[model samples]
Target: MRAIQITEFGGPEVLTLADLPEPVAGPGQVLVDVTRAGVNYADTHQAENTYLAASKLPMVPGGEIAGTAGGRRVVGLTADGGGYAEKALALEGALYDIPDGVDDMTALGLIVQGATAWVMLRKSVHLEPGETVVVHAAAGGVGTLAVQLAKAFGAGRVIATASSPEKREFALSLGADVAVDPATPELRKALIEANGGRRVDVVLEMTGGTVTDQSLAALAPFGRLAFYGMASREQPSPISAPSLLRHSTAVVGMWLPHVLTLPGDIMRRAMTELFDLAAAGTLKVVNGGEYALTDARSAHEALRSRKTIGKLVLDPSR
Candidate 1:
């Protein structure tokens, strides 16, 4: 099997394609003939060694994959890495059968980003039908899914923030009621004005740094802000403790990997619900682009450059 391996942490250039032995499944795991591997910011972060968790060097950097396991079409998350290869080993429970209409690339996108979006919207925030919600990075992997899921949950209004007009328009097409450029000086005010001067009831904060602070201003009283990813790749702003108490808004940090450990039942339920939504056509996975397995470095560059929208995947057959 050929896999992209990072011998050292640095940049996309550090990811090198090399021949590797095929991974064998353990007792509770199944060996997958990987068809498509989901490329996420976490993969880039791991390559750069800047992720929240320390990445093991000489590792293959992909979390989710869609392929065949034990003769069954499935999508799964791999904790032991090696997803950038032609074969990967995924836990039995981590693998779910791909629905009839979902393609390999789309199923790969849904496994990680879709699960993150569903868990955050459905469990973390418990978004209400008539409440307004704000989604940051509205055109990225999880952001695109989050926007659609918020609407499916019957959010009264969904305000999405992106860096460019094209991304904003993309989010709008995905069910965002209003899309604003977060780079604008009056972004918060614009979001409020667009949503009939009502503060958002829930905020999906992906970009940290100054954008996170701006999102704080757009939160309604008693609202929940689920801080999921730090796309800004900068140190988070120092939040004022007093302001949080005064506003009565809750700030929650979500780490999807942690869910795998605590409450196995919840993880199973979430994946089942997400797969059901995908099967029903209520949830759509937007595949930004697909790259050959050897082009892993290029995939990382595309994500880091913010030149791609939706989810990117690496095709093993290529």
Candidate 2:
């Protein structure tokens, strides 16, 4: 099997394509012939050995794949089993049967970013129908999905924040009631203005850097903020302890890999709804260009640069 292997942690250059032995599925695992693999910022953190959990050396970075196992079409999350290859090992229990009407890209989008967006709002915060939702990084992978899912989940108003006007427009087309630049001075005030002078009820905080402080300040009374990642790779501003007490607000953090461990049917249920939305042509995935499996280095560079919008996936057959 061909794969991009990392024997040492470093930059994207460390990801070298090599002919590696095919991974055999062990006890309850299934060997997946990979079709597409989602590229995420977590891959960059794994390459640098800076992720929350230490990445094992000589590892494959992609955590989610849409492919086949035993002739049954499926999508699976491999956790740490090396998905950046032509073949991946998927836990049999983790496999989701891809329906005939759903395409691989939609399935690919649903597993990682799609599921993340679904879980955060549907399970984590229990987003209400009329709540004002704020989504940061609203044009990126999970951001785009989060924007769409927030609307589907009945958010009354969704304010999206992005770095560029084009990206902000993209978010608006995906159901955001308003999209604004987060780089503007007094970002919290800008977001509040974009929300029609209302404070936020829920926020999806991805790039923590300065957005963390700004988003927190914009939270409504009894609001909740789901801090997921620090894509900026910069330490976020610390929250003042009194801020939460002042407004009866809450701050919650989520890491997809960690949340996947909760023993329950939440993932399956949300995933089913996501797929149904996709099949019905409701979910809009921006699908940042697909690259060849061997071009993993460039893919990582593109993601790190934040130039690509929506989800990026590698085509092993490309």
Best by TM-score: 2
Q: After superposition, how far is residue 71 of candidate 1 from its true place, in Å?
A: 1.0
lDDT of 1 at 128: 85
- Could you list the CA RMSD of all candidates, in the order they appear? 1.3, 1.2
The C-alpha TM-scores of every prediction are: 0.96, 0.97
Task: State the displacement of the C-alpha of residue 132, model 1, in Å, after optimal TM-score superposition.
Answer: 0.6
lDDT of each: 0.85, 0.86
- Cα deviation of 87, candidate 2, in Å: 0.7
Looking at model 2, residue 40 earns an lDDT score of: 84
